[model samples]
Target: MIFTGKGFRFGDNVDTDQILPSQYLVLPSIKEMSKHAMEPLLKDFSDKFKSGDILVADHNFGCGSSREQAPAVLKELGVQVIIAKDFARIFFRNCINIGILLIELKEADDFQDGDVISIDTVKSIIINKNKTYTFTPLSNFLKNIISKGGLVNYFSAKK
Candidate 1:
């Protein structure tokens, strides 16, 4: 799949709480919880984000709690992809489980906030302005999972 979006930039060590605070976890739905996403860092992040927007961050993008709600909230807010220097392992898994694309690139720092970026998962390329960066392509199995909308739907379709 391919995704194109405006980049929303952030710095290092953005933890789970910053993505979706613990207080909002008690909310009934992800839609409600998303309104509070990135509240600590960017007060109006959720309100301003649009579908297909990309999140670009420095290393350890999801470093704190292993709460799956963090990525869930972003997905609910229509964030299609995230590009980071690196990701906390559990958070990385959580994002994949929920079908939110995450890509790691040492060159992530090159992207600026609001820069329009195009990601071709099929080609494992990230294109911005006059530049292009490549990432390791996803395995067919993983690609299938995401295409089916995460593991649950993947397995459900198998039945």
Candidate 2:
């Protein structure tokens, strides 16, 4: 699978609350929840995103809470992928469970916000301008789940 988009940047240790504050958690639907995504960290964040945009972040992205709503809100906001130096484990799993793609790259700092980039998950490459970076490819199992649009859809297709 490959994804291409302009980047949206964030720093290290961005937690669930920064992604979506608890105040908005009680809101109904992913659409309502998404309105507040990154509200605290980047006011009017929802207004800045376009469909198919990419999120780039430093290490420990998604550092607090095991809230599934975090990734869910991002997905609802049309963030196609997140490339971070590293991820908080539970958040990583939650992202996969909900069909949002996350990639780890120790050299994540190489790219800046709004850079047009393309990711070739099959080749494990990230292309930005004339530069290229590599990342560990997702396993076939994980790829299958993402392709089917998350675990629920993956299982539903099987049945």
The TM-score, computed over Cα atoms with residue i paired to residue i, of candidate 1 is: 0.94
Question: Tens digits of per-residue lDDT for model 2 on 1-159?
Answer: 789999998899999989999988889898999989999898899999998989999989998998898998898888879999999999998898898888999988888999998999888899998898988977889888988889999999999
Residue-level error in angstroms, candidate 2, position 140: 3.0
Candidates' lDDT values, in order? 0.91, 0.90
Report the C-alpha displacement of residue 79, candidate 2, in angstroms. Answer: 1.1
Tens-place lDDT per residue, model 1, 1-159, is 789999999999999989998998999998888999999999999988999999999999999998999999899899879999999988988887899888999998799999999998878999998799999866788778988989899999999
- Model 1 residue 12 lDDT? 94
Enumerate residue pairs that collide in model 2.
none
In angstroms, the error of model 2 at 139 is: 2.6
TM-scores for every candidate against the unseen true structure? 0.94, 0.94
Q: What TM-score does candidate 2 get on C-alpha atoms?
A: 0.94
Model 1 alpha-carbon drift over 4 Å, by segment: none
lDDT of 1: 0.91
Q: What shift in Å separates residue 19 of candidate 2 from its native position after superposition?
A: 0.2
